[model samples]
Target chain A: AQSVTQPDIHITVSEGASLELRCNYSYGATPYLFWYVQSPGQGLQLLLKYFSGDTLVQGIKGFEAEFKRSQSSFNLRKPSVHWSDAAEYFCGGDNQGGKLIFGQGTELSVKP
Target chain B: DVKVTQSSRYLVKRTGEKVFLECVQDMDHENMFWYRQDPGLGLRLIYFSYDVKMKEKGDIPEGYSVSREKKERFSLILESASTNQTSMYLCASSYPDSYQPQHFGDGTRLSIL
Candidate 1:
């Protein structure tokens, strides 16, 4: 079965500090990876996705993710953190036709 | 901007009552999806439609049914509402034959009494 793993359940980073959220997946073929962010009481917003080519993909809100096939990892990164960026981050793998297998999600808390 | 709209932002239904959650997308997307969001569980796919009148079950499809009479609209129906079914229901749409990102609505927070 295809599955996504976000190792961290919760991560806290100080404002102005760099942030990195780890994600790994297990799939048989080349995978389509995505990162989504959900604010409190709101629907998820797409942060970025990696389908093919360009191992490093940029996304909205100054977020970028690097797809490392050898490592089976797609980690989201940002140069600086802001309090507004505090939200739940989810990593998912697409199974065609818009079907997504999502990780348990990592709750990010941006501290002052 | 691609807009996906849900019929309601919040809803309350009694147990054993029938419930309907409607979603519409305006981007002429060929694919539409329904998912439930819960704390710690992230998002779980319930059902999806690739075309008009064509539906497919996702990871979790138990106790739920879907209808897609039109290309831009997808409706999720709960035969019998239960407390466990109370969740944030999200609707999304995406284009076919492309890696385009799925656009989402604000989501409907449903509560079962």
Candidate 2:
């Protein structure tokens, strides 16, 4: 079965610190990848997506993710964290065309 | 910009009552979907409609029915609401072509009493 796994259930980082959220996917072949963030009482917003090309993709709000084929991972990263960056992040994609399978999600906390 | 809109942000209903959730897309997307979002389960697909009157069962479709009378509107219906059904419901739409990023609505936080 195809599935997305977020290794870290919760991660806390001080404001301005570098951040990384780990994600691993299970599939028979190369899969699609995406990163999304959900704020409190809001819907999931697309941050970045990886389809076929370059392993690294940039997304909105200064977020980026790299797809590592060897490790079956697509980890999200940011150089510096901001207070507004605190939100639940989900990793998904690589399903039947547009069908997306999302991970359990990692809750990010940015402390000042 | 692609815009998907859900009818309710929060809904409260008694157990055994029928429930309706409406979703509309302004981008004329050919595909629309309903998903249930829970604390640890993430987003589970409920139902999807590719076109008007055409629907498919997603990962979790039991106790739920969908309607797509028009090309841009999709509706999710719960046969009977239950306390266990309380969840955040999300609506999304995308182009029929491959790899289209789905646009999501703000979501509806449903509560069953």
Candidate 3:
């Protein structure tokens, strides 16, 4: 079965620090990768997505993700983190059938 | 901006009662989906509708049903609500293309007592 994994359940980082959230997937072939963030009581917002071209895809909210086929990973990163960036992040992929398979989210905490 | 609106932000229902969660999208999206969010489980697709009157079962659709009688609305139905059914239910919509990103609603936090 296709699956997405986020190894870290919770991560804490100092404000202004660089951040990387790891994600790995198990799919038959290259699947469309995506990252979404959910704030305290809000719905999820799409961060970035990797469809085909350029392995490095930039998304809204100063976020970017790199898709590495070799490792089946599409990790989300940011050069500098802000307190407002503290949220639960989820990595997902499309099953090519309009259905999404999502990872067990990673809750990010930023400390000042 | 594409707006996907879920009917309720919070709800409480007793076990064994039927519950309905409504979702509406203004983008005229061809696909609408229902998912449940849990602490350690992230989000699990409950059901999805690709077109008016068309529905499909998702990974965890055993206890849920969906209705898409119109183009802009999709409804998730809990036949017999249970305590285990208490969850943050989210609704999303997207274009028919598989690559299109889904737009999510604020979600309805439902508690089954």
List, residue by residue over A30-74, the lDDT tens digit for candidate 2: 777888899999988999988888899999999999999999999
Residue-level lDDT of model 3, residues A62-83, one tens digit each, is 9999999999999999999999
Docking class of 1: medium
DockQ of each: 0.64, 0.69, 0.82
Report the TM-score measured on chain A for model 2: 0.97
- Against the true structure, candidate 1 has what lDDT? 0.92
Clashing pairs in 3: none
- lDDT measured at residue B49 in model 3 versus the true structure, 0 to 100: 88
Worst lDDT window (10 residues) for model 3 chain A? A92-101
lDDT tens string, model 2, B7-110?
A: 99999999999999999999988889999999888899999888899999999998999999999899999999989999999999988754777789999999
Clashes of each: 0, 1, 0
State model 3's lDDT.
Answer: 0.95
Give the candidate order by descending lDDT.
3, 1, 2
Q: Which stretches of candidate 1 lie over 4 Å from their true place?
A: none
* Model 2 deviation from the true structure expressed as Cα RMSD, one decimal place: 0.9
Any runs in candidate 2 off by more than 4 Å, and if so which? none
Error in Å for residue B20 of model 3: 0.8
In the order shown, the chain A TM-scores of the predictions are 0.97, 0.97, 0.98
Q: What lDDT is reached at residue B105 by model 1?
A: 92
